[model samples]
Target: MQIIVFIKQTFDTEAKISLDASGKIDAKGIKYITNPYDEFAVEEALRIKERLGTGEVIVVSLGGDNVQEQLRQALAMGADEAILVASGEIKTLDEHIRAVILAAVAKKIGFDLIIGGNMAIDDGSAQVMTRVAERLDLPQVNQVTKLNLEKEKMECWREVDGNREILLTKLPCLVTTQKGINEPRYPSMKGIMQAKKKVIRKIKAAELELDLEQLNGDEVKSVWETIFLPAGRKQGKIIGGEFPATAFELVRILHEEAKVV
Candidate 1:
């Protein structure tokens, strides 16, 4: 089995985000790490490779050169090799075009299985995996929690409506992982050392044979006009006194003060 895991470098969840004058995210001086959910995808891919005791686990990412660090981390976690689709010029492209780039890469490098996060933390866009599947003409299952692979067939359980749903798909399928799939392993000293020596193949968008018009086109269907932090939360008020008096006061506060009666 040749499994490919798609990962991304994103701002740490705990990082404080701010917008620039152009209404874009201000990334200067912000800490970047591998997308948390993608970690689960990497872990699940490595686990599948280990279970089979054969084949390779290749980690792939689409971003600027800065993403090499995240790819190295995936290598330390047991991926055999890595590929990077360097698209620094089109860094702000929409997810539709991003999925096209990924699908092009997937076509260049075939795979038996593809895994990625169900959603990216930064934008929370959960469309990439499905789009890639559509472009590749392969079936996909999302937010998979449990996966069992046997030969060309797979049995898995996924989360839906706060409930679990069992699913089965054949080989050459894509899966987007959610939390609870498996605990990600920390890179040990030896693994880190090994990661430094692994080679990460880098390819430009043009090298993938993508359309130039698509790269420099005004085909965006959605736009982010502006961004700002949420307003500060107001302090809560306490209603004093006992029993009926307190209840009446609460009702009065809701009807008059908060105006939510």
Candidate 2:
């Protein structure tokens, strides 16, 4: 089976991000790393590869030209090779739906199992993998925590508010992973050295031949209606009246003066 792992490059957690005119962050000289959640997806794919013993694993991403750096990190960990949808232009989160275009590209490459992180660190939309699966029109599972290859299907466990959800999905499905699914292994010294020499082919977005018109324009907007912090309360008073009297006074103040119950 051929497995495709999707990875993303994102700014460090503590990055001092500043929005530009288009509401996109300036990435001119920022330090970046693989999306932490996607790393788990990569580790999961590597584990499956080791178990199956013989399968091709490929990592891919759509971003600026430098995105190949992130793909190399995947190669160092265990992926056989990588592809980058390099376009040298920054894309906003909403605009990232262009990944749908990549899905058609991946279809031509022959992938049996597709995996990606739960969300991009910067965007955190947790939407791409599911959309990619939709574009492919194959079965898809999102934010799975436990996954096991069973006799006839893939057993996936996802977290819910009060219980765990289990599902059995057929092959040729895309799975998006959260961090708890698997612990990504650190790259060995040998792997690190090899990564420096690994092959990373650049595939321009235009070459992918996706309909760019279908990839732009979003209607949702965060107006921020108001943007101030909440007000802190003043010091509290220890009342001297009887307990019942104090209770009555407290309720009165809370409702009449504070306008809160």
Please give the clash total of every predicted structure, in order. 0, 0
Clashing residue pairs for model 2:
none
Expressed as tens digits, the lDDT of each residue in 1-261 for candidate 1 is 899999989999898888898877899889999999999999999999889999899899998889999999999988999999888757356788788889888888889999999999998989989999999999899989999999999898988887889999998899999899999999988999999998899988888887757566764546667677889899999888899999999999999998998
Candidate 2 lDDT, tens digit per residue, 79-132?
888888765532433433545656866886789889888888876777778777
Candidate 2 similarity to native, TM-score: 0.78
Candidate 1 TM-score versus the reference = 0.90
lDDT (Cα, 0-100) at 166 in candidate 2:
96
Output the worst ten-in-a-row residue range by lDDT, candidate 1.
214-223
Give per-model CA RMSD. 2.5, 4.7
Using Cα atoms with residue i matched to residue i, what is each candidate's TM-score against the true structure? Answer: 0.90, 0.78
Clash count, candidate 2: 0
Question: How high is the lDDT of residue 67 in model 2?
Answer: 80
lDDT of each: 0.89, 0.78
Q: How far off is model 2, as Cα RMSD? A: 4.7
